[model samples]
Target: MRVLAFLDGTLADPDAAHIRVDDLGLMRGDGVFETILVTDGRPRELGPHLDRLARSAKMLDLPEPDRAAWERAVRAVLDNWSGGAELALKLVLTRGIDGDPEQRPTGFALGMEIGAAVLRGRAEGVAAITLDRGIDPGLAERAPWLLLGAKSLSYGINMAAIREAVRRGADDVVFTASDGSVLEGPTSTVILLRGRTILTPPEHIGILPGTTQAGVFRGAEKAGFATKVEPLRVDDLLTGDGLFLASSVRKLTRVRSLDGTALPAATEAHAELSAAYEAEYA
Candidate 1:
């Protein structure tokens, strides 16, 4: 069952929740959103998710999100949640009707089930194909209009890449930039394990800052694992001791293969990593 609530704190039926047709979020895909993982009725890294939501809004020139109102909306949904081990809590803020800046932005929180396919990926892992993202990574600094680093609602390309991956007989996608740097998975952050070090591309390379990945790095550090943020090349993805994709909803899923090539399974290290992930953080 899905539960939804508005910024004003009214709980509603998710299936029936509606927004005005002229809302720019619907008209032009103009808005920002954050998907948070709810485990055992608790939101993981909620502060980070909200922080990112605000950052995205700033990038899109939307009104600053009212944090307390969103928090109240989230609480209402969780209070109404049906018992479950996992949920996807999405908080959305839109450029409201007619795209008027003077109007209150449209906002809501939705709590829903995490799909079985997604859970299966976390357990059995995924097979992915590499796709060229078709942009110079460095260009993002010069092409601010592209909104490459913001988690805005303009995700047609990301979804299309995943569809292309499936057509190529893969379960997911890893996008490479014009410079041939392995950027990230369409919906998740890529992390590589080498010895005791866990590495990921820095956010400065024109990707959204990953909240769940930051959480994992903290966990890894406390468990004696080192962490670094560096650009990853496609070759590096193939040579890592272990490859993982992290997201709020998926938590951490191993990448069993890439472009039809099997990667090393750092079993013991991965187990320890999983253990650390389960320990979670405050």
Candidate 2:
């Protein structure tokens, strides 16, 4: 536990703050959350992230979050933070106090952390491992009632997978289905490129619809490249000309190797597109 919590309309450390035993969020992970990059005191893509979080909360049958209150809470945290050229802000809204899993609480908890950003800017890119995890085909396209697209706190499995990848000498892990089709990274979106055309798995395939991915497509199109979304296979990736992982924090990281085999790093065209998107956001 770290000292990063905004509880009950005040700034307090999580370890020092007291929560009710009936808090369903703590008991059953009954909550929705969003992590945004707060640069120069402004949270990027705040609107879309909050919209997704609200959708996720509704899917879980949790009480609707107070949008204005949540926004104010984040602003309060930012206002108190002293320094950090760049910071990460996390907004979590869970059913605050409830014993029965069948009942929703009237309030939610908001937490945030101010820390150094994970830097990933080098021509020598990161290595990755692909995990063959199975995702239900139905949940791939339409958001499921249970598998809400909102960010949940139950991320033990994802953290374990990342640890496994790091133990294997990879900086990150790319998740694949049992059928060998590509999905996404543990926290980023996957993209494959051939020549100048940019390709990524459709979000309908149970992949997280990434904000950075959309920015990449827009930048690529502006730079005169054909951007498309399609189902990608392992062979397609191995044979593809280049590979990249897109995210708000990481920006764009080239996948230099995959499953012990080398992948063509993002070429000049890819770098140009990435820089364009970064410039737009910066």
Compared with the true structure, what per-residue lDDT tens digits does model 1 show for residues 150-215?
999989999999999899998999989988898888999999999999999988778989998988
TM-score of 1: 0.97
lDDT for model 2, please: 0.72
Model 1, clash count?
0
Model 1: lDDT to the true structure: 0.89
Residue pairs with backbone atoms closer than 3 Å in model 2 (clashes): 140-206
Clashing pairs in 1: none
1-282 in candidate 2: lDDT tens per residue? Answer: 122545345666656646676676788787767777667877777777777777777767777777787776677676766656566667776776765556645343333344223464334577888887667445644557546244676666678888999899887788887677888887788888888798998876676678778878887888788888988888988998898888766667788888999987567866787777766667
Location of the lowest summed lDDT over 10 successive residues in candidate 1: 273-282
* TM-score (C-alpha) between model 2 and the true structure: 0.85
